[model samples]
Target: MVSRPHGGRLVRRVLPRDRLEDILRDSRGLHQLDVDDTIYRDLENIGYGVYSPLTGFLDSVELESVLLTMRLSNDLPWTIPIVLDIDEEARRSIGIGDTVLLRYGGQPVGLLMVEEVYRYDKRLYAEKVFKTTDPAHPGVARVMSMGDYLVGGSVEYIPMVRDGYEDYFLTPMETRVLFRERGWETVVAFQTRNVPHLGHEYVQKTALTFVDGLFINPVIGRKKRGDFRDEVILEAYKTLINRFYPRGSVVMSIVRYAMRYAGPREAIHHAVMRKNFGATHFIVGRDHAGVGNYYGRYEAQEIFSEFPDLGITPLFFREFFYCRGCGGMSNEKICPHDRDLRIYISGTRIRESLSRGVVPPGEMMRREVAETILSFENPFVE
Candidate 1:
């Protein structure tokens, strides 16, 4: 059976339509806090139960707990801290116990019942969450750019119209319903950011063989340079699933959360999210969510040992390669071929080749998927 939500219940704070007028009317003449797309995405996810059990942004206590223990104040396993940062001026102007409306692009996205506003040490936050304070690291760089103070409180999520990619947007509740309809009690979720290659397919299909369904939940939002554009990633997957995956065995959905390349911590965060989406199992392959050499190749898999009670069964897979001896995809767990005889399917190498207009060999990525990617004038995020 699919596991219970991370905190025993899904958190859906989406403001009901009938109550919208009253909320909007009441929000006026209060403190207005302008938020960007990233914060809006957080609100949307929390409202949709993607970050279940988190009714709103984390307060000082919750933030400190997550940073120090990789869990919430209640001791639930929550790796990443979901917070709303504001400038010093707003921190002073928007006081504790005040009601503030979070606006993006002049639209009311949510309301925050002001509970506490506090400052955090950026360097420490970077070091704790990402294991590095190097400014070059994308996750660290994000921390460096955050505001002076953090806002916290329970949120009344106001759903905003997320234009484009409407077809792939599925809330946690919606996906759970879909899984139930498909009789998928043992769904294995594969979290991804890059376009699919054969090695990814190998791990996903391998996991699928042991589960009732495969959930390809790709994170779509702000990304680092050279990563596939959000649209390209979605299109490439559509081609792959439609052409290769067995009908009724796979479901492709997009999670509109910003990527935090926290490696091990992010791996746990991803698993928690998939668990909330009703996944009974999650796949954590080599270097899952790692960037550069910030984390060891197996660190993401190893960190799962710290949380035996995380609730979702994590399926760890070693790096896969095309073994000339086996004549097919094989990993260290099963392959007997020497390293010299194997052609490793590396996402970085594939991306470099594609950026230069080269379609990789069918052994690495299928021609259909390759062609779909190459169709874009520039597929990488610029």
Candidate 2:
């Protein structure tokens, strides 16, 4: 049995002290949270670049609101002060030791069972210190090389909310165990906070060609106002899988955790979390976890190469395009259609169409998916 701290206003969590210390040292970039230039500079100081999913979800105003949530909200169980992962004010409040129970549409869906905290050692950090003018100065190149060695493994634990214990779905461990027990050699997971589009179908189907199974996991937690309802997405997927995909080839489920929209970083974290749930691989595509052009098109793909220890191979698929020549959905190589022949349904454009009661074409969405979007109230519009 484990003990939990008491206090309605204070969030409580359990974490290893050594790991917490390393995280504090490694995450020094948090301080430069607001300024994009400074934030990137700090990331570079730590041997990384700045590109995240939150780029589109955050602006000056929203960033400040999230910052307040990080500092002032009691709902979060993790204790660390969320540093500037987004615009100056954008942040999340959960420290090292807390348990996060996630829900979707009033149903407990899953939990982020975090444990086994690892941090960067000062010795490793010391080894990387460089003196610009001194020949004896240590080279940071050494430190960057040891980043994975410093903190490479993950912890095992479960999440729960006191009053809603049963509602706290206990599937992370079971899911991992069951997948391993079965003969499924590879499982590739996809994360979504949006409705499925033609492009999504292309990726998931493409992933199925290589992996034994595909998990179409959609985040059903708190999302942007304009985002479609969880039920709509789920029902549409069900219709799609039944009519189009091979039976038992795809497993669609809801991942009801509030999104950080931290783009590339979030993609890494999502892949790691899915690995914890027993996925052997993840499908990452252009603008993954992205809202707008704040992060580059391929930034998420680039970040995966930076962390090789993850062991989860990111199957990077090219963007999908509708080729009039092929008369169906296709990727860059297979599609010979010119710019004028293609039809795209961006999140912004989809929402715009829905606001006016217009269903997007099969090019942007399937007929069933389009109908589903039209039936629902436009959260962004009303």
Candidate 3:
């Protein structure tokens, strides 16, 4: 059976086309606020059930719960805080039960039923969510940049934004339907921000051997400098999937959620999203969602033990490298070859090679994938 969604039900906050048209008839007079592309992505995810059990931005209570307990107000395991922060004075005239139209890119993208507007301590949020107050950390930097107020309420999303890679975008509902139609009762989701390499392939196929299908979900959004561009990751995966995987055994999709780099907490958050997408299992790598040296290598794996009720099974594998002795990718759990014969698969090395117009050796990345990546003039995010 497919795993149940995080809150035991899929949320549908999207307004139907006819209903949206009706609402827009009075849109000009509504109290409106402007947000960024990240909030637009959040609205889409919330409406489409990617963030199941959460119909709106977190209220003060829910935000406190998630920040301290790493769970929602109802005790469901939720890690990252999904919030709508605005300037403090923005809510002065807005009372509870009011409706605020949220605009992005000069268009009304969604509506929020204003339930509560509250203030929070920025450094505390930084310390609790990202575990550090250092401005160098991307997550902390975002926290520092947020407004003084958070508005919480249910959302009525009007899918106005076109996140790139429209051809491959799949909502939670769509993925669930496709999984069932294909009879994939045990699908394993592999999330990635970087282009695939042989190390990735070895881990994915090894997991696929135990599951009915593989969900190749790429996390797409504002990634850090030097990370592969969204299109590069998708195109490279398409090439690898079509050329190597068996037919009808894989589904490629994109999730346009911004990365928080919150280490262990983000791992659980990732699992919950994939679980909502009908994946029975999720792959958690060492330093999952970790940036720099902020977290221990196994922290992400160890955090799973706290949430035994989290529906998706987490598959933890040791770091992999190519062993000359075995002439294949092998992890510490398998290959017994001496270190001298091993060519550890490093994403940095591959990126450096590609940046220099040199294709990484086949031991690290497939020749086809390397070529595809090389074809891009500047594949990394600037």
Q: Each prediction's TM-score against the native?
A: 0.95, 0.57, 0.97
Per-residue error for 373 in candidate 3, Å, reads 1.5
Ranked candidates (lDDT, high to low): 3, 1, 2
Cα lDDT tens digits, model 1, 6-78, are 9999989988988888878777688998897778898988888889899999999999999999999888999
**What is the per-residue lDDT of model 3 for residues 1-382, given as tens digits with 9 covering 90 to 100?**
7889888999999988997887789987788889986788888889999899999999999999999999998889999999998986677767789998899988888989999989998898899888899999988998899888899999989887776578888888888889999998899999998899998998999999999999998887877789899899988998999999999999999888878899999999999989999999999988999999888999999999999988889999889898999988899889998999999998889999999999899889999999998899899899
Which is the better candidate, 1 or 2, if ranked by TM-score?
Answer: 1
Q: Which ten residues in a row have the lowest lDDT in candidate 2?
A: 1-10
lDDT by candidate, in order shown: 0.90, 0.50, 0.90
Give per-candidate clash totals.
Answer: 0, 16, 0
Clashing residue pairs in candidate 3 are: none
Name the TM-score of candidate 1.
0.95
Q: Model 3 — which ten-residue stretch has the worst lDDT?
A: 87-96
Assess the local accuracy of residue 194 in candidate 2 as a C-alpha lDDT between 0 and 100. 69
